[model samples]
Target: MSFEERDHTADILMHIRAADTIGLFTDAGHALMKTMYRGPARPIEEVSVTITGQSLEHLLHGFLSELLFESEVQNIVFCEFEFQIRDGEVRAILRGEPFDPAIHGGGTEVKGISWYGLSIRQEQNEYACDVLFDV
Candidate 1:
């Protein structure tokens, strides 16, 4: 399926009747990751996972956080991430490989989730969220 940039930014949306509860849309920014990752360019392996929720911001944070945590635990690092949301359902495709322990920050470890300074807002057609992940 061909997709055009919905906007200069990565925020994605689609137009469909409200009844189209099962619609699917893909963002170009996400499509690029299919071939390789970004931070240091690595071949992609698996690129598909689904997420369901109510708030977009919440879902996004949870999804990305889970991916990063999994990567750290499994010693897998990916540079690119593609996200798709429909009817509050999210699908993510991650591409990358497990990098050496030395590649990451010095003495860093995935602790757990945190509530400190967590925030998300959508105003005047703009949306943004901030999540603090424990190290």
Candidate 2:
């Protein structure tokens, strides 16, 4: 799995490529966390989220949105994710620690995940998509 930050006129854009659905979610989650928080020396807490969508694209949006919600409501930064995807639903276990300004360097405050320019496709053995985050 791999991801790169793309140039956007406003907000942040990320393009992710993975070999499977689970890998895609894992990479996207890590990319989002890295964009907002530096990291914690060690994980101190865990969060679990389950989301269902009508399609793969919607599922991706829901996954990212849930991550954003957890960050804001819990005041934490997630670093690890283990998830399973089946029938347009995702059940995930995320591990991280409460955000500490001193340890987890601050970055752009992502407001929300946007569907603009969103795309999800399968090419040969890989799945790829572009995600836009409102900042």
Candidate 3:
């Protein structure tokens, strides 16, 4: 699984591709991490969450939004994601450490994850999606 930054006029757009549903959600975290912090950080701190949504898109947005909340509130930038999504429910454990401005500040700050243009779809054996990060 992998994620790539794409051009956007007002926000950060990331195209994520993975082998399965879980991978799609997992890579989304990496995409967010890449957008928010440039420096390398170890997974010393852990954040866990269990959330539910109305639909797939809602679940995705909710999950990403939760991560964003943790990042800002805890002053941490996550580097790893482990998620289980089923029946509109998500249980996840994320790893990150305190954000050090000296090393992590060069990256753009993601204020929020946008609902606009957010979508997840399956093509063949792979899952692909796009998420917009409001910065």
Candidate 4:
């Protein structure tokens, strides 16, 4: 799993790649965490969520948006995840600890996932996408 960031005018553009569906989404989650928080994130708490979307791009957007919302509301930075997708439904188990400024702060504040360049594609054995994150 790998992702790279490009500086946009006022936001961050990320291109993520992985070998499979699970890795693609998993790395995307990590990308979000890496953009928003930097710390020794441990699995102190576990949370589960279900999200539905019409397509893979929608699912990815919803998943990332949900992570941002969860971090703000729960004061957590999720670093671990288990994802399962079927029939346009996604189930995820997220694990991380509550936010601590001393440990989990000081990264770029990602306001939201942008829709402008959001896309997903698969080629042979790899999956990749371009995500523009609003900062």
Candidate 5:
């Protein structure tokens, strides 16, 4: 799995590539947390999220949005993710610790995950997509 920051006009754009659908979701979650928090200084807590979507693209958007919600509501930053996708639904276990301003340096504050420029497709055996985040 891999993720790269892409150029966007006024938001954050990320290109995610993975070997499978679950990998795509996992990498995207990691990318979102990395974008907001530099890195986890300590792994102290874990959280789990289960969500459903109409399709793969929607699933990705929903997954990222859920991560953002967790950050805002629980004041945590996720560094690791385990994803299970089945029939348009996703079950994810996120591992990380509470965000400490003093320890975990802050990065860009992502307002929400955007649908703009969102695309997902399979090339050969790899799955890839471009996700835009409103910051």
Candidate 6:
């Protein structure tokens, strides 16, 4: 489903489930979908997160990595996420704060989100994806 056409809760759940499935095989990835508000978008806030999916690892890493990408590239906090996962690919509409040294990670730099070490396959009506985060 498109980010605009998805149910927030369902999208988050799917991402989590996908991450969890990956965790079952290995602990090298995370999945997250969130939309930030209060900063640029309306009704969203910083330090806010909505976790979905049954995959814990994917949810965690995906959230953080997306945050990392925002901080470094966009110089935003991106505390909120509007998430959708389809065919193993996650589409997120993120909103958060601008770069602040206080919230930034120390001595840790996120390389990027990689298609490597990951897979997305269709399983009936649902899409399954295993993604690896580059830390």
CA RMSD (A), model 2: 1.3
lDDT of 2 at 21: 85
Top model number, TM-score = 4
* Candidate 1 lDDT tens digits, 29-127: 222222123345464555566777677545655565566555655565665666666667878777766664445334334354344433444444433
Relative to the unseen true structure, what is the C-alpha lDDT of residue 75 in candidate 2, on a scale of 0 to 100? 88
lDDT per residue as tens, model 4, 1-135: 599987788888888889988899999899989989987899989889899999988999999999889988888889899999997999999999988899987898988999977878887889989888788
Clashes in candidate 6: how many? 25
Candidate 1 global TM-score: 0.57
Task: List ranges where model 6 is wrong by over 4 Å.
Answer: 1-70, 83-92, 121-128
The global C-alpha lDDT for each of the candidates, from Candidate 1 onward, is 0.45, 0.87, 0.88, 0.89, 0.85, 0.40
Over 23-71, each residue of candidate 6 has an lDDT whose tens digit, in order, gives: 3222222222223212232324444334454443355445556565555
Show the lowest summed lDDT stretch of 10 residues, model 5.
Answer: 37-46
Clashing pairs in 1: none
C-alpha TM-score for every candidate? 0.57, 0.94, 0.94, 0.95, 0.93, 0.38
Q: Write down the TM-score for model 2.
A: 0.94
Q: Between the candidate structures 4 and 6, which one is better when assessed by TM-score?
A: 4
Residue 38 of model 1, lDDT score: 31
TM-score of 4: 0.95
Model 5: CA > 4 A from native? none
Query: lDDT of candidate 6 vs native?
Result: 0.40
- Residue 102 CA error for candidate 6 (Å)? 1.9
Best by lDDT: 4
Q: Identify the superior model by TM-score, candidate 2 or candidate 4.
A: 4
Which sections of candidate 4 miss by over 4 Å?
none
